[model samples]
Target chain A: MEFNAIYVIVAREFKKFIRERSRLFSAIARPLLWLFIVGAGLSRLVPSDTGVSYTQFIFPGILGMTILFSSIFSSISIIWDKEFGFMKEILVAPVSRLSIVVGKALSGTIVSTIQAAIILALFPILGFNLSIVQIIAVILICAFTSFSISAFGIVLATFYESYESFSVIMNFIVMPMFFLSGAMYPVKLLPEILQICAKINPLTYGIDAMKHVIFKFETGPMSPDIPLIIDAAVIILTSIIFVLIAGKAFERKG
Target chain B: MSIIKVENLVKRFSDITAVNDVSFEVEEGTIFGFLGPNGAGKTTTINILCTLLAPTSGKAFIAGHDCIKESAEVRKAIGIVFQDTTLDKDLTARENLIFHAYLYNVAKDKMQQRVDDVLRFVDLYSRKDDLVKKFSGGMKRRLEVARGMIHWPRVLFLDEPTLGLDPQSRTNLWEFIAELPEKNKVTIFMTTHYMEEAEVCDRIAIIDNGKIIAMGTPEELKKAVGGDVIYIKTTDNASAKNEIERLFKFNVSEKENEIYMTCGMGDTCIPEIINTIGEKVISVRLQRPTLNDVFLKLTGKTIREETSSGNDIKDFVRAYRKRH
Candidate 1:
């Protein structure tokens, strides 16, 4: 809650993230591959129902992928801390477990948002244009999405035993969520059950929102930006839930 | 005055009773050694004292602040250098110190000075700008101590402070820690598995199997053994143990290679016993018992010489994780 505590946590997380150049590299690469290579190649392969360019149709999903991956991958740092006994140091400090959650959430969400920013920077170059305010809203959308997913990752980190096991779990959890969240194709592309599954996915709203921003997909059937607002709400709520859970977990650890 | 007080402190993890009914007071300006073997709950006790783990029941207070009720104050009052290293290897010594200062909310103006002061105190000021990843084993351990001091804590908790150090480094750290009381009346509570190491503490509680076996100053504990010690080098220790048990009534404890007996007047008892058991004797020796001897008397087991070896896979990975 205090300024100095927050600064220490943020600065430490920042230092850790930057010092591990691999985290920086992988953070950008995962989304780029999904958006450019996977999204672009699959664009021509899938029949275009929306009648939009393949890359354009999936831009939302790709951006959502950006948020999901960044948040999940940042958890590696947590595992690293546990392995290195840094968690013990942080645990023993004068700061509250709640502040720790806040600090990790803030730094992780911001860093993940920056990864999305890298993708956003490439968006215009890829010929997807947005007005300046849309750009600001997009960053906020990514931030919230990242916040929710990263909070989930942080909670998982407490339970994670080792880096290798953490990687396996992350793959199982994150990859499915990425594909199932209607990021690749519209939810309509799936079976009825999958569509139902998509309805529960928080990324669906986030992706749908990004899609509206990038592709202007809200025409007659869907409100211009209803999904975005809904996704944003779910993300904020989930982030709050995960932070509280993580806070309680850390409190017990102390 | 006692700077630390614990009353019936108990800690449990599911069915495992890690520490039970452990209570002690550490006097101000005194280094209280908490001595125990591996799995002896030494770390758990220190964890409770340092506010890192709450007792499942009972209470512990640091510098008069309750660990449960006033954890924030307790955390502020004490510094802990855990058995495992906890420094950020990616950062320089100065950066690491400053970051810890920020957590303690040291003023920005004072933070740099404190960082400088601690680094110098640890004899690490010259290498303050070097990355910790580049540091050797001793350097990393020293930095952990320096980091704990950055906030100028009123008490310091060191869990197995020299568990994995070479003899030279261990000696250096002991001297460094022993001087803290003179520098300031900072109450020092350190856990150590090494029996010889605990002798330097003003007082020690010998803990084993999640309980305190004995508690006293080194001299008091040594006095607990009474007169000279009789160490019997027995090829048949079991028979030797039973034979010695029937022979002396004062106190007797045996291990693999030796049978030890303590009596009221060893000068009179020892020679007669040596004469009585002459034919079966390997050798007889009468000497002063060290803390190790006292621990052997209390525990009825040899003081284990298990060094913190990195040869084991688990230890290597754990140590590697601490650094990398």
Candidate 2:
């Protein structure tokens, strides 16, 4: 529970993030491609009954995807640290193991949030009008989503020994999570089994909560199948569970 | 008071015992060395003492704190320079030290001054702003040493501190390590395979195959090899060894064509030994015993022979050739 130790870890990660200019570029590029190319192209092929444009409808999903990818990849640095021997220094320090886990999780959250914020700044170009309340809601939801996803990443990073194995496993899990979360399409239109899978996904709650706020602001307040309160509850509960699991995994001998 | 105590400490990895029934004591403010060949459990013992790896049985204490039960206190009281480089390559030297200071909970106001002091101590203050990735191997090792001392722990554990450095860099690093006890009042527990490096230690424990074979001061261990070693090369080696053993009443071992034995004042005995078996003696050599000779006498093999399968000697040879 030493806040200084946590702060120092977070500060070092941020310093590394800032220095790696290429990583920052890729973080923004991936979401923009989905928004401009994928959203625009798919919208022309399949028209939506909702009055909002396809670009507007998928904006929140794109933001969620950016946060998901960035936060998860951020935790891969743990494996790199282990390979390079820096992790041993951290493991032997007087700080509690929980602080190291929390510090890494928090840094990933901040990095993903920053990446999401960059996408949020482009709202004007996308021709979306938002009130002060909706803007605050979007930022808050992004933070919560980023924190949850980053914790999940830490849990995986702890168990994985090498980047090759981690990358393979992440691709296996990440693609399914992203596709089934209804980021590209609405869950209501999916088959029964697909809908059930989407319902169980923690990310489904995040995107649903964001869509609720964004769509409500664009149109009148629409009652989604999953209420905002339920989405918020699931996101918070999942985050706590992930943080605890990651802390336990990190306590194991490296 | 002993700064470190290990009693019957054991560590096993599934079927193999990496450290077995090890026992030793390191007095405060002295450099205690573990000299052995590779895979001889030297690093394992150091890891157990540092709290990075727990012993399977038995016990260890650092600064009177149990390494297992009181790991937090033990961790706070000791610093470690791992065999491999542990500094963050992307960060500058100052940033790396600052991060270490924070992790050890150095006071916020004193952090900058402490970082500066350690950087200066390692003589890397001039390049503090450069990224560690740009540093030479010796520079990186020096920085790791400085980083380990940033918090000023009561004990320092250096695992193969100069494993891959050139002779000059190794000597330079030893100079810095030798001064740490007097300058910083830190007790050092180090493990090295190099016989020459072990000479700097106040006392050394020679380990092989996960057991301590001998423990004492350098001079004492060397003396344990007997007064002197005599190597006699003869046309008929077996006859010469038998002749010497019968005349001098000494035990002799032969390898290849040379008959080797230890005798009191080998310089004085060589002439008598040659004269007693005058026609048999082709050449004779008399020499004082070294730590290598001590290890050979105890283990029946030189330290380098034990490590022929490992890369330490190969890397040493490569580094030596590169320098030449």
| lDDT score at residue A17, model 2, on the 0-100 scale | 92
Docking class of 1: medium
Q: Over the stretch B204-249, how does candidate 1's per-residue lDDT look in tens digits?
A: 9998878888999998898886657676776676776776677765
Off by over 4 Å in 2: A217-225, B232-260, B267-284, B305-324
lDDT of 2 by residue, B75-95 (tens): 999999999999999999999
Best by TM-score: 2
lDDT of candidate 2 vs native? 0.87
TM-score of each: 0.85, 0.91
Candidate 2 lDDT tens digits, A123-215? 889888878888889888988988888889888888777778775866787888899887888777779999999998888888889898878
lDDT score for residue A204 of model 1: 74
